[model samples]
Target: MTSIKPGRAPSFLGGIGSAFAVIFGIFWTAMAFSITRHSPFGGVSIIFPLFGILFIIMGVVNAVYNFRQATQKNRYSVLDITDSETEPDPLNERFGPIIEGHVFETHQGDVEFEAHDDGTRDNRRPRFCPYCGDDLGEDFRFCPSCGKRLPE
Candidate 1:
């Protein structure tokens, strides 16, 4: 829908999935809830709802994670890419090859996708550059982060 800024990570989805997990989980659990007291799992009578809530929380967490990833910032190219260039075909581009932002990935996947997202509250601030995990300094011109030159 929107252009992804190069050198950026997708938006951090915060507590978004929490809503979904709670909703669907509740729905499924709710069905069992009514039947529990009437059915087999009704010994305590409220356990069904308790589990439902847990599921809902799970769903919400899942959704938030997904959304966060989708919205996360992306590697920003130096030039503007028209829809025609990217839409018709990704490989075909008017601007010559451009360097995108850096990515700090792990075995699981990228944690600090963009250089700026590095923060204590947001992420653990991996020992390496947030974008590339490479060693760098505060004054380094290129991204010790990803070895890419910082935009002027």
Candidate 2:
């Protein structure tokens, strides 16, 4: 079975702009036609009808653009989309510890984990540093490998 993810909603401003453009376009076109047909006004300029046509074209363009934008998947990640290293792995534990002076490959780069006297073992290790993939302890306040401050 295929699961289709929900797409982002259309922009409010785009929708509103399209609606107003179409409505005003229709209104102006109608007025232009009326004036050309010898309405109460003596004579009407051609700019009104030209503007109405332009607005109608603009409305159609806006609607199409908004529809395409709405159907596209919105990704906010700063990393490259093709970079699999930074992709989320739900199966892997968030924290994995490595022995001090041990080097491991990571999405960021070769990271060396720091060893602590906290009895951290293979199954009970932190996965990587939250800021970068370095060895971190559960009780760590700062990453000794990268020198980044860690959360308490």
Candidate 3:
């Protein structure tokens, strides 16, 4: 099995590039506005401001996207695959003692036996109700949620 390693967050270089773009956009827009106000160029001057606005919008979007990525807890978009097949399942690792034929104790200090057993203490209960996709206990003769007869 292939194991995937967590990847690095969005680089600071990207943020720097975005900042440069926004600065250039602001400068370009200011220059365009000043030129249009003084010169007799008329409607043609509108194109410069529009291009500047486009650059500003693109830069802001890129910055915001990078900021969100940087703030995320799991920045694992880029995965490094490795040939490590012996990794344990996370669920099993968490509930190993309870799942290994041991009685589980509730928060209220009540111990509950495995519900899904066929008299020999082996957990043979169906995990889910096929009809409605609801979770099922081991002793269920029918789906409680969907009221469908379960397979024997």
Candidate 4:
């Protein structure tokens, strides 16, 4: 028993080549018939039609194989995010701790707000310094990493 391993779908080039082979096979068969009808040779003339038939058979077999391979579905199950029990976190799972910053203007002037990794923006102070990206544990007048003064 022969087991075939899973493979990718047939490429565009393969399909085009198969189609050309079938067309060429038909043309060859037609030409063979015309040649045999006009030729005076008896026994040897039979080989021409035999060769044409062989070409047609090979071309048809290749075309059918390519068609079947192209249409077969993948063996593995596709990943469906919606079917999962819990929703996946895009920012935390994919990006790994990304800080999205937004600025708003009020009567007091431009105010900067940092969006946490949980995708929430509640006017909380930025956890990391904007200049050096160092962790800001508490309110500070300056960034300890780059020694830059924080904006008042």
Candidate 5:
């Protein structure tokens, strides 16, 4: 398998789309004015509707493509609560052991944090480690390699 690096959205495509949107607005306004049979904006009146339509189509296509790029499999959007447990639930009391790791999932993948903690001398903050909970160092807020935020 191949790994993909996270990168920012392409600015070129956005610039082009934004340009089209602006042109679309201009053409739409001109066309509306022309259909009113009032050529107030001057000479470009003849192709107003044509430009308007072209711009609209291009702009829509660009938007769709950008949306798709933004939602790709490797992109991380937010955290999800995968599994939880409560030793016992009492009225007005919270459920579960302090808190456990989340079964993180992304569009293209999933990551599991195991509790690999020895639970004795780990000076790290409260977090989940694969075997027990001893593997994670407290210096970082999120997993340094995978970017998973340590559960509070």
Candidate 6:
């Protein structure tokens, strides 16, 4: 029903997770140091220091990873609700067809290009459906608007 927008930034949950990881890392590292230096809890298990140190390392790694994710541009961590019924002829209605060396059509209609001196037109393909002219987003095998199967 929903998904992350393309080229979006990270979600707020990522930052929250990163903050938790950093706090946990600091806590465990301090605990490990304390356990190794002066046994705060008497008769503590021999593995307490090792376990604390291991968790400290893991937490630090997780923090860094989460922080990096949170800072990425256009990389969202949540699904966003979208309307499938977008304007079909948005480009044709707005900018119309552009006439350069090639006839660069807008987003709504088919794009036509003129032949260059090398007797070849540009091969850049649109991400939308050439048949129904619908945006083919990231994970669809078929066009939602029309029942056309998209090329993989």
Task: Provide the TM-score for each candidate, comma-separated.
Answer: 0.31, 0.38, 0.42, 0.40, 0.30, 0.34
Give candidate 4 misplaced runs (Cα > 4 Å).
1-12, 74-152
Off by over 4 Å in 3: 1-10, 38-41, 76-152
Deviation (Å) of 43 in candidate 2: 9.5
Cα RMSD (angstroms) for every candidate in the order listed: 17.4, 13.9, 15.6, 18.8, 14.3, 13.8
What RMSD does model 3 have? 15.6
Clashing pairs in 6: 7-74, 8-74, 8-75, 9-74
| Residue range 32-58, candidate 5, lDDT tens digits | 656846766666565666667767677
- Candidate that beats the other on lDDT, 3 or 4, i.e. the better one: 3
Between 2 and 4, whose lDDT is larger? 4
**Which structure among the candidates has the greatest lDDT?**
3
| Residue runs of model 2 more than 4 Å from their true location after superposition | 1-13, 39-45, 74-152
Best of the candidates, TM-score? 3
**Which regions of candidate 1 are displaced past 4 Å?**
1-23, 38-43, 74-152
TM-score of 4: 0.40
| Model 5, backbone clash pairs (residues 3+ apart or across chains), number | 13
Shift in Å, residue 2, candidate 4: 15
Of candidates 6 and 2, the better by lDDT: 2
Candidate 6 lDDT, 10-93, residue by residue in tens: 434654665676567567657766756666655463456556566556666655655565566545435654322343445545
The sequence of per-residue lDDT tens digits that candidate 3 reaches over residues 54-96 is: 9999999977766655666665354543211234345544654
In candidate 5, position 95 carries an lDDT of 43
| Least accurate 10 contiguous residues by lDDT in model 4 | 76-85
Q: lDDT for model 5, on a 0 to 1 scale? A: 0.50
lDDT of 1 at 31: 82
Q: Give the per-residue lDDT of model 4 (tens digit) for 1-152.
A: 12344344543345557878878878987888887876777865677877877877887777766665666664322343221114434544454332354532222323446565677776766567655579876778888887967656
Error of 2 at 66 (Å): 0.9
What lDDT does each candidate get?
Answer: 0.50, 0.59, 0.63, 0.60, 0.50, 0.58
